[model samples]
Target chain A: MGQPAPAVLLPDMSAAGEVSLESLRGKVVYVDFWASWCGPCRISFPILEQLRNELGPEGFEVLAINVDEVEADARQFLADVTVSYPVVRDANGTTPLAFGVMGMPTGYLVDRTGVVRVIHQGFRKSDGEPLRASIVELLGE
Target chain B: MKTLTSLLMAVVLCGCETVQPWERGILAKEEMQWQTNVSEAQLRNQIYASKEASSGGAGASGGGCGCN
Candidate 1:
């Protein structure tokens, strides 16, 4: 059985208002939990960004949440790696806690119906291929 | 009576500090985390160094001992 994703409504660092996972129900949503200090998170961000850019028009969205307690640290990280997708700050670390994130750079792929199709923890370059394939397949559905 | 006692002992021995999947969310809470104890460690090291008249890796350039 597909599990429904936990409710997520967080402050957008780049925008003025909050962005909710509920608002992204019809799209294939990728909910990412990342921290600036996590080494693998640095490796995963650009690759996930590419996937989002390539598949975004096909009803896919990447909602990357920065779990740094200090929002400025996340901003500094963004300065080094610029991505097009909507990025939000979970300064209180509430969302990652809710998602049961044991490590940094955890990702949850939700289908269009808001069901969690997959959960990925940590990332490598080759991991993107399988992830992209899954995204494409989800888009086809 | 012996069999019943053995069964109870086996069950108690098997159940040592295993957190379930659903209960992991509580364990993942920020308050339940120990990563923030780095400062506590730093404080301990500083106190030890001060008492021993030794200063090393105290965020400054010093090759006092424990390999920089």
Candidate 2:
């Protein structure tokens, strides 16, 4: 068994609407904590989009949680990226603190059983390979 | 005064040792001092924020501030 996912309620994606960890049960979820002003975040965003498209229908979900303090910047970033997946906003970082996120582009992959299996600290192109492999493994491929 | 000068020269000679590029393998070990310092990481985080527009690169390493 992996680490149990901590109970936390994330903010709604300002561009879309509300979403929560509890609502995403029964799927392998990749939770990415980012902001509009982080460079590594910008680079990893596309990879995340690709993962969502490639593995999404196979029960993999990407939750891009924005740590931007302002709603305007978050909205502008959404327009900038054109991301299709939900981008939740952490207006006060309550959820971020609960998740122990240390830096931008940090990712946590929780299995369908709600056990967090992988915790990635940064975004190097090298980081994505392991992440993808873990997702594929969890999805039973 | 001459003894002091000799002692100082000896210390300087001992301090002159340098590590060549290949010798850096030991320094590159994880336990070495080259690990990312928290303050330096914050400075780089600001650079990252300015260049990429994102935050939260390492867990609990950042708190929301105008710094990034």
Candidate 3:
């Protein structure tokens, strides 16, 4: 909130695709930085999917940015996990570095203006209630 | 006689190989090699960012370009 939040334009699943934080303006966005091999990341994927489906129509978006080195691995992981949100493959993890991610499964709740309101780190399934509450608050705001 | 004593010592040492579940507490200590404390996390993150192509884990603040 001090300086402007870092801007990240990440690659989308489509061959010619690219998505940017700036493009997500006017909607509440949840940007999650994660890797395929991270255990906690695997654990939280389903919860994220639920959030996306449950709140998508309400202008909520979940962007799962995979930090895997290989695009195939990222794709395979998503295939196995079956997440409903957009899975951005950061093969080089450029977006993650721009966001200063120090931990796996770190999520940024950004409001409609592209301003990050809350940062959630290393969340567990048990954290579903509190995490949902934070997302709701941002959505309401 | 000396060979028998050496064999007895070997068995005693080998018997100590098993680690009980309760003893795992010591293995789980913050001071242990696998244990991560605040400072250690910082160092490990720095190392991980530099060495690994992928990023993100748990705990810590901010982001960096070390991995990219």
Candidate 4:
């Protein structure tokens, strides 16, 4: 999309802290908006974890935004499928509005410079390959 | 007359509100589904289909057999 990703500042779901998009400016970031009830997200999480693990040392980062109104639901979902990436909670939901997210499990590939290069809506098993390729290309830059 | 119709349409459209993507979690809840219980829905659908000799469409069309 070639648009600068909107600034996201939200509480980290894991620890007693917060995470922001600005902090990850130097890395190729995957900004994913997800909810516990989103079916595609269950599929997307593992693949995202795989990408993060494989490409992390190369400066690839995943910043997941959980949009669940009930934090417990998200925690339960995460308990079933865990990821090492920094997962933040946007309980107020202002972040998704800033991103103009139109569907669940939306992903924005933010290159090192903070501009969103790709917008992926809904995920399938086949999408992992292309998403990986995009991140790899961005990291190569 | 056209101005009055346009005004009416605008008034009606004003009642419509867009539910943002993230807010759809409530809609995705199990209680919000048309049939909250999958097994119960399946059983009801089976009975209805057997009685009417039709299935699917949620009452959109009759069966080809014209039994209805």
User: Number of the top candidate by DockQ?
Assistant: 4
How well is each residue in A1-141 modelled by candidate 2, as lDDT tens digits? 267777656556654457888788899998888776666777888888888899999999988877775667667878888878777776666666777776666789989988889888778766667788899999993
**Count of backbone collisions within predicted model 1:** 0
Candidate 1 per-residue lDDT, tens place, A1-141, comes to 178888999899888999999999999989988877677888998898889889999999999988775667678889999888889877666777678776667899999999999899888988999999989999999
Candidate number that wins on lDDT, 2 or 4: 4
lDDT (tens digit, per residue) of candidate 2 on B1-68: 99999999999899887442212323533477654586886787677665654457554355456363
Residue A107 error for model 3, in Å? Answer: 0.8
- Cα lDDT for residue B17, candidate 1: 76
Interface Cα RMSD of candidate 3: 13.2
Report the interface RMSD that candidate 4 achieves against the true structure, in angstroms. Answer: 0.8
lDDT tens digits, residue span B1-68, model 1: 99999999999998887542322334554687866587897677766666656675465555445333
Deviating ranges (above 4 Å) for candidate 3: A1-3, B1-68
Clashing pairs in 3: A100-B62, A100-B63, A100-B64, A101-B63, A103-B56, A103-B57, A103-B58, A104-B56, A104-B57, A104-B58
Model 1 spans with C-alpha error above 4 angstroms: B1-68
Note each model's CA RMSD in angstroms: 10.1, 17.4, 19.3, 4.0
Poorest lDDT segment (10 consecutive residues) of candidate 4 chain A: A9-18
Best by lDDT: 4
Error of 1 at A23 (Å): 0.8
Better of 1 and 2 by TM-score: 1
DockQ of each: 0.05, 0.02, 0.02, 0.70
Fnat for every candidate: 0.00, 0.00, 0.00, 0.83
